[model samples]
Target chain A: MTRFVVSVHIVPRQGLLDPQGKAVADSLRTLGFAGVRDVHVGRHVVLELDAADAASAERAVREMCSHLLANPVTEDFELAGVRPA
Target chain B: MKVGVVSFPGSNCDEDALLAIVERLHESAVLLWHKDHDLQGADVVILPGGFSYGDYLRSGAIARFSPIMQEVVAHARRGGPVIGFCNGFQIACEAGLLPGALLRNVSLQFRSMPVTLRVETSQTVFTNAATAGARLTMPIAHGDGRFTADADTLTRLESEGQVVFRYVNAAGEPTEAANPNGSMRNIAGVCNPGGTVVGMMPHPERALEPLLGSTDGLVLFESLLASVKA
Candidate 1:
């Protein structure tokens, strides 16, 4: 078994209202960053676990994202990276 | 009838729910801890309001994995009466005991005020005693109480009478101005297809007395009592 560190990024699903992101974008526009199109606030989670290999570790984290890390109904998750810990 | 109010790590309204049943409805009630697996033979279960798990990872997301939730899920699957209020409603959605999801309030504000709700249906166990068109006032305190679902689900809920309550104006009409947190279609409460499980963002237990502003919440407790007895 190898210890692997996985990073996952979860974001609000498209077409759903992201209030915090909107607030941030509004603030950015007020700050003179007129080029801002939009922003969607979400979350990033990092986990360290022992798995047989990198593929298994990524697969396991994907399962975690579907089951608990990210809400399937409202959020989408993707693995940002995986590395030996 | 015995009512069980689950007390999660940060739940603040479990006692209010218990008292609503015992003091107002004259029914027996108990507090079930999040770590315990037993329901104590409770006939009805209430997932009360408050910031369970400190609203981590989207409100009730984390609390849904508590040890007691497994038993609660089983109890719900057995056709037991279950109701979730505010944070409890979020938890119910996370647990899949109810459909849809609660997103961050569109106003980006933690709304803590009383709002008017039009009882859309009295067919569910939670609102059986309420008139179909009755207006009730209750308090809602949450930052993530905006209910959202797919377009198809919304259409089905509307057609099948799953939408039990809606935010309404003083004149009892659902309007954009009446929606407290930008919930879709101004929905304030909903029930499962079977009408046995219900979830709402309003804190009915907090409005059980006139001194607290309204006693309209008592009708919900009365409805439950009547349903269980029947």
Candidate 2:
């Protein structure tokens, strides 16, 4: 089995309501962080796994996103993984 | 024999849930509006999805104080099996019937997608029909599905095996990329001390038929029915 490094973000999918993100953007501006015009929040996750190959691991990771991790309708996942160092 | 789908003012999934429970499964169900009390003799109370009160003032924050929720809490306290989905999960947390709060999505966006759930424990009525490590594919639609709790509570919940399901990847694998809402430790659903009441952000009732593309969720409803008969 090959070990790989998995890094990804889990965010709300487009078209669903995001009242919380809007509130935070306003708060950042209120706090005098003016340079930021648009802000969206999502989780950044890093994982290490042992698999036969990167494709297999990616497939596994993608499955997790579709079935469990990311909600398909409203959320999108950006992921990249490589063989462990 | 009767399934109760609780309906808050803005809840849109009541009828859909009822159809899944009755038409697909051939079981009897009732739509209990938020104002009505008594649960209408429902054996299992299911809190369906929707943006209650328009998701205003935080997801499910206001609905926690609804009249029926009080009774729901009382009923759950007495060891009745209650299932909460999506906003219902948020309301359950708000009412202190379950642990953790459903915060805004990590990306601060609304999420509507199919999620794979890994069954962490199958001791409860809802999950008993499946094996402990069973994987279920279901749809989860919510914004504040990020689950957060105090460190102590988190430890206890983990130690007691209260975690029911976790979001995973498309191939039915458990990994970080699939965790849609940034739930703590990838926690998607949990139960109370009694284990009878379970709250989950994923909509199991939403996937009771192949027309929706999966029947993995039907096991939960069947388990509840079995308990009702027991």
Q: In candidate 1, what are the lDDT values of residues B15-60, reduced to their tens digit?
A: 9999999899888999999999999999999999999999878889
Candidate 2 matches the true fold with a TM-score of 0.73
Q: Highest lDDT among the candidates is held by which one? A: 1
lDDT of 2 by residue, B1-230 (tens): 88888989899888888987898679899988787768988888888899898876457777877889888988898898888889888878777788877877877678888889999888888888788877899888887888877677889998998998887776666677889987878899999877798999999878877888888888988788777788
| Steric collisions counted per model | 0, 34
Please give the CA lDDT of all the candidate structures. 0.94, 0.81
Candidate 2 lDDT tens digits, A1-85: 9888877788765544455667788899999999876666676767788888888888888886665455443467888545574
Docking quality class, candidate 2? incorrect
At residue A33, give the lDDT of candidate 1: 99
DockQ of each: 0.87, 0.06
